[model samples]
Target: MRLADLTTIGVGGEPELIVDAYTREQLVSALNDAWDGDWFVLGGGSNLLASDEPFAGTVIRILTSGFARIDGAPEGFQRVSIEAGQNWDEFVAWTVAQGLQGVEAMSGIPGTAGAAPIQNVGAYGQEIVQTLVSVDLIDEGSSEIVTVPASELGLGPRTSELKRHYGEEPARVAVIAGITLDLRVVGTDPAPVADERIRAALSLASDDAVTLAQIRERVLAIRASKGMVLDPTDADTRSAGSFFNNPIIAEADARLLPESCPRWPVEEVAETVQVFDLATWDGQVPRVEAPASRVKVSAAWLIENSGLPKGFSLPGSRAALSTKHTLAITNRGGASSDEIAELARYVRMRVSGEYGITLNPEPVFVGVEL
Candidate 1:
């Protein structure tokens, strides 16, 4: 299968083989087969950035399906289990309809449930780590199916044990099968007067019974405006969500920015703000990497100020920035991966020349390095 067909970016070359597994048993069998022959686990294909060259290895596309309630109070709280292949936004919508509050802000995120905990996916001031209870994984070395708690998963800032290669080689392949989340159920009535303030703080209004569905709708609306939702007709949604994780920097370093820069404390010693640099990768690539020492700046802001306005492009070029958002590089149609890369590089260079900061890409590149 062509990587362009599988990825949201609509770029990349073809793969050696593409196997879609739609059942749990089939998924497990496929993973075992990949382990025997060596293959990569491909989930929703949202966070990946593959190369333009044809991939030589097998691509095991996870398609398993199922969702169930495993535990928690039937009246006030519940633990829900979901298969890896279910669309993430759909799952969030379903949970919201049931009155779950834990994942309300994560609505409209592309990809599958299994991929969520992989990076502890977060948005709008919330992260999967906050509510993820456990994950069922296939340990490649032992060939055992293990259920690991969230803590054991080693989740942090778009990384996990599965990503860090803690106990195995860097390319060690493991297939995530499912996950469990602990969700709270808000009752119809407001809490007693003594606890009213606390309930309000949590967004549980005194007269309004906020169900999960309402929360999901609101979250989806917010994501849509930001071009985070999936919409094939909108080129703005043609790439991964945010291209960079906001950088966390020391409080002293953050003070160097203009007073208009937003500041928030991530830890006692660290404060973060989003800054953008267009001169990243030394002008060879338009990329953004979040350094641990400086507050993460907005790539969009850097691009606009660097003279690359939204929809900026070379004359007669097919690739351009999304008109709705400056952070995305869109395919005006038939745009190659290299073309997209070039535009990204241009943006990065311009931003750097203007702001002395570099922008980094958030997508995972394969077959080609930028």
Candidate 2:
């Protein structure tokens, strides 16, 4: 089967074979067999960029679907377990209809819920790490199914132990069978919203009280504006959402960036707030990763400032930057995988040459290099 028909970017070459697994047992068997042979597992195909050359192996498509609200999880929270192949936006829409609150800010994200924790998917100040209680995964080595707590996943801004970045193997080689989220239960009423990032994203007043549905709409609108939301007719949406990750660099290197560039500290103020009683507190300071504190610079800002503006592309190439967001490298109708890679390489070269900092891509690459 051609990956061009399977991936969102619509640029890849064919695979040796395509197998769709619609049940848990079928999925497990497929993974086990793939481990013994050359194979690749594909999910929603939203976060991948493959080569125009053939994949040279079997491709297993995850098509399983199921979701349930499990009993005895926690108080004031709804614990729901979702199969790996369940459509992400569909699940978010369902949660909004049910009056759930935690994932409302992540409303229009593409891909499946199972792919969420792999990259610690987040938007408007909300992330999967906040509510992800556990995940049922299949270990590639043992071929055994087990439940792993969210804490052990080591989820950060856009990383986890299980996400395989370019030139870097994931800390763990396992496939998630199901994801369990413990969402805040708002029932059916407006809740006071206080997350600054979310408020900024939605352009809400600090004191605004909003319902889960309202948050979802605002988030979806924001994503659509940036072409982050999927639309078959929109050429800007024909790409892996963000071509590059926001570069997380040392504070010293960040100071070299232009003052107008947007940046965030790894150890954010929200996480370091003091809530303990001062009168009863001891004098000892808690140990922390001093070097863990970093500065995340905006990749989009660098791209534009480095002379690659929105919709920019090499002459005669069909790959272009998203008109709405510089972060996305889009297929301007019939763009080849090589064309996409060329654009990516050009962007990286320009940005690095101008700023001396390398920007890493966010998508998983298969049979392609930049």
Candidate 3:
């Protein structure tokens, strides 16, 4: 299987075997077999950075399909179970149509529902943790299917127990089968009210009276403007969403910045990390969050301030920063994964050298490390 074919970036090499599972039972069996035989699990490939070299192992593509309302009180608080294979945007749209209000802000994120809990996927001031009730996982070590609640999973900004492997090396591999989200069924009017809050927070609303559907549409438009939404015609959309998780730093560290830095509640910040915005030497602003009760900083600001422009490139390079967004690194047709990795490394090193902070990558890397 060509990694390029599986990824949005369209630059990876190939895998030895690619298995697509369409049913829960099949997904479980495949996961068990792969665990016993030592195979890698590949999901939507949205948040991945793969190497250009061929992967010499089994690649199991989760195609499990199931969407049902398993439990709901008469009052309208319900639990919706979704398989990992369902496209996330479609799921969000379905929920919105059903009068659900929790996931509307996350409407345009790429990938599957199963991947949501993997990184606690969030956007537009909302995260999966707020709505996720439980996750159905195929325990790779035990080969048993278990339903773990959100608390048991240790969900932190873009990090989860499923993401952090236990035993042996910490960051090993684990496969997710499905996830259950607790959704609130509100009146159509209520949805619009909730959407008003979202739009207000995102600054996409000129007035506070936008309808729910209109809020969703406008948010999608905003995301599309930044290449956050998927687009076949735009190479800028050919990325694993944001390349770096906003950096969270200590409060003491944040105090070093000027008073203009934006500060929000720790909980509003990802990972209980106090976050602050940084003003670049060139006047651009970047936001950062610290997961350990500190502040998060912006890597994009650091990159640009550290002498890299939005479209920074080495001489005769095909890989460059996305002109639409500074945080994203793009494949400008025929670029290799190695070139991307080099660019990423260059950005990280320059930022660290200048700011005395290390920028961590947000995407999962397959057959490559930076």
What is the TM-score of candidate 2?
0.93
- Encode model 2's per-residue lDDT on 185-220: one tens digit a residue: 887687778788888878888889888899998888
- Higher-scoring candidate on lDDT, 2 or 3: 2
- In the range 148-212, model 1's lDDT, one tens digit per residue, is 88888778766687763212333334678899888877533322322343244345555555445
Q: Highest lDDT: which candidate? A: 2
* Runs of candidate 2 exceeding 4 Å displacement: 268-292
Judged by lDDT against the true structure, how good is candidate 3? 0.75
Predictions in order: lDDT = 0.71, 0.89, 0.75
Evaluate residue 170 in candidate 3 and report its C-alpha lDDT on the 0 to 100 scale: 29
Task: Report the candidate with higher TM-score, 2 versus 3.
Answer: 2
Off by over 4 Å in 1: 36-38, 72-76, 164-173, 187-211, 269-296, 352-356
lDDT of 2 at 292: 49
In what order do the candidates fall by lDDT, top score first?
A: 2, 3, 1
Q: What TM-score should be assigned to candidate 3?
A: 0.86
